[model samples]
Target: MIIDCHNHVLATALPPGHDRFVREMRAPGHRRAGRLPAYRPATDEDWVGLEGDLDPIDPGTLVDDHVSAGVDRATVLAVAPSTYTAYGERGTIDLGRVTDVDGPLEVAKSNDYIASLTRRHPELIGMSAVNPKFRGVEWARDELTRAVGELGLQGLKLYPMYDHYAPADRDLAFPIYERAVELGIGVMVHMGTSSAKDTVLDYGRPGALDEVARHFPDLPLLVCHAGFPWVDECLAMVARHDNTYLDISMFATKSTQRQLYEFLLRARQLGCPLSRICWGTDYPGGGKPAVLLPKLTLVNDVADPGAPISRLDVANMVGGNWARFAGLTDWSEQETLEQLEAWEPRWRDS
Candidate 1:
């Protein structure tokens, strides 16, 4: 089955007195706590980008689009900027303010809406967001438990750099990690570039994850964006650690295509297993399937040529691999070919 492992959904509820939609885009870091940036919400541009005359956020629309694209499933995370916003020099600006809807009930309501969506579409798996800095370890653990055990979420999504915490800093995130491991919940951490204005570049590197990996060797960890600027370091980390894996999110842009190709070739030469790498669209931010498909095709074309990776591989990268990593097994693989027989004809025609 094919899966888009990294996509986000917006909360349906708007804060009281707040516009149902956001018009003015706030600067990267402006507010902390609940004053986080809400999803731009669906726009005509987003629909056009998806190659659909209508918005794709609806379950039926999304499912139909995925099936047409040869994807069988997708995993979604809630879009909460505060979860990733960091401290800026001007003051403490955070995406958390976006979640600031008067109280925790609002956050729960928003999360429940996404969870309800997952229930409506079995193909869509859910991931709940948690900001350890905002809620201490105990509260974070309780909320995560509710999200997973009660809400049936597959895992927890975290933005350490944006939350002003270092992935490797045990004092900051170890409690949360410990709770996740105890609860058997997978943790996907944002690695690489900070989306925040006051981000510290060094804190987001793959190496920063080493301490966390060492501390919780059994915890399933996914480094999104393949740690971008440090792709090699990410590959190396995956090569050395059994529990570490990388996701190809927001890396299919034109500017990074050649670098990605080179990195894949070199990593293969270095004996990195293809299974360690997974696909992700980064959706809303990376553009939709229509724009991302060719880029994904480009990477597969240069890496495997003839056989390349199958659409199933794409699915695996998007969701399946993460499922296995998270300890879920409700997926099936497609037929394998001894060799890629369709490459020459496909490449020539394309």
Candidate 2:
């Protein structure tokens, strides 16, 4: 029942001519989406060290790692960078040049790949991504319908900052939101600073989701990363919106865990239900399971006796709450713990 609510799979291959395109985007003094400080060119050693490092590996290996880390389920998301930028900017701009301006098709392929992965691995739930800015409204709607309806993806992910659209842009994004409501699936919105160079930072602020939540109060919405630096604002949004959730992805470090625990304590004082919070690693960004598990387990160790957070809170944050939120019916906290203990002998008896 440990449902990891957010993570991404690497593209199987770099798009043709993307190397040349990135080089051009990296011309002196010009910021580019792909130019994050953490960027490193892939190498043979990276490929060989897949189990220990960030190198892309097969889905089976991803599942094995999750099991070793005591996770029972994980949600994988698709990303479409071309949807984040217009022809002049970083994300979509370079892709357009490389793909002969057919960048949207690449996005479709990514979504298709994730869908296929989910089909092969039921333990891995798939979330489909579409850029309303890259494709027209009708196309966006159709792609979403295809992903959820035909492809059977359980949710949708929208990256307004990477895709260069404001989350509050009702005119541009409402149609997709409307469709999500009709489909009975959740939507995950990326909120907070994106690694993409020069992307619209303001667009990702947690408050931006307030309008949409107000507009579609019934649609399940997730604010990924708990909106990072804007954590207080994120808490407010979750407090006001019944259907909104905050996931602790990318907050797997020990220091950030303390920040999150404090935030959760404050949220409880404000009468916000603990159920609205969920766990996520943002995977590759949060590092591998071995690196992330101890950071996550720290929440369990530090649950002060009289604090709002309890040992039970740690259990729910890791998986129980997510199962209920994600509409999973087969999960049981006791059963999950037993199964995980059986799988990972290192997990101490609870």
The lDDT values for all models are 0.61, 0.68
Please estimate how well model 1 matches the true structure, expressed as its whole-model Cα lDDT. Answer: 0.61
**Weakest lDDT window of 10 consecutive positions for candidate 2:** 90-99
After superposition of all CA atoms, the RMSD between model 1 and the true structure is 8.3
In terms of TM-score, which candidate is strongest?
Answer: 2
| lDDT per residue as tens, model 1, 166-188 | 77766658887888898887788
Question: Which regions of candidate 1 are displaced past 4 Å?
Answer: 11-64, 79-105, 108-110, 198-200, 254-259, 297-300, 303-320, 335-350
Clashes (N, CA, C under 3 Å) per candidate:
22, 2
Using all chains and alpha carbons, the TM-scores for the candidates as numbered come to 0.72, 0.79
lDDT of 2 by residue, 1-350 (tens): 67788876643224443333333323321223222323555343433422222234356767887877778788888775362333232221222222222334354465677777788788899888877776687888888899888988888889887667888897888988999898888889989765445468899899999999999999989899888878778888889989888888875432455666677787776665788888888765566765565455555455567764554666677777766656667777787556544644364432
Model 1 / residue 298 / CA error / Å? 6.0
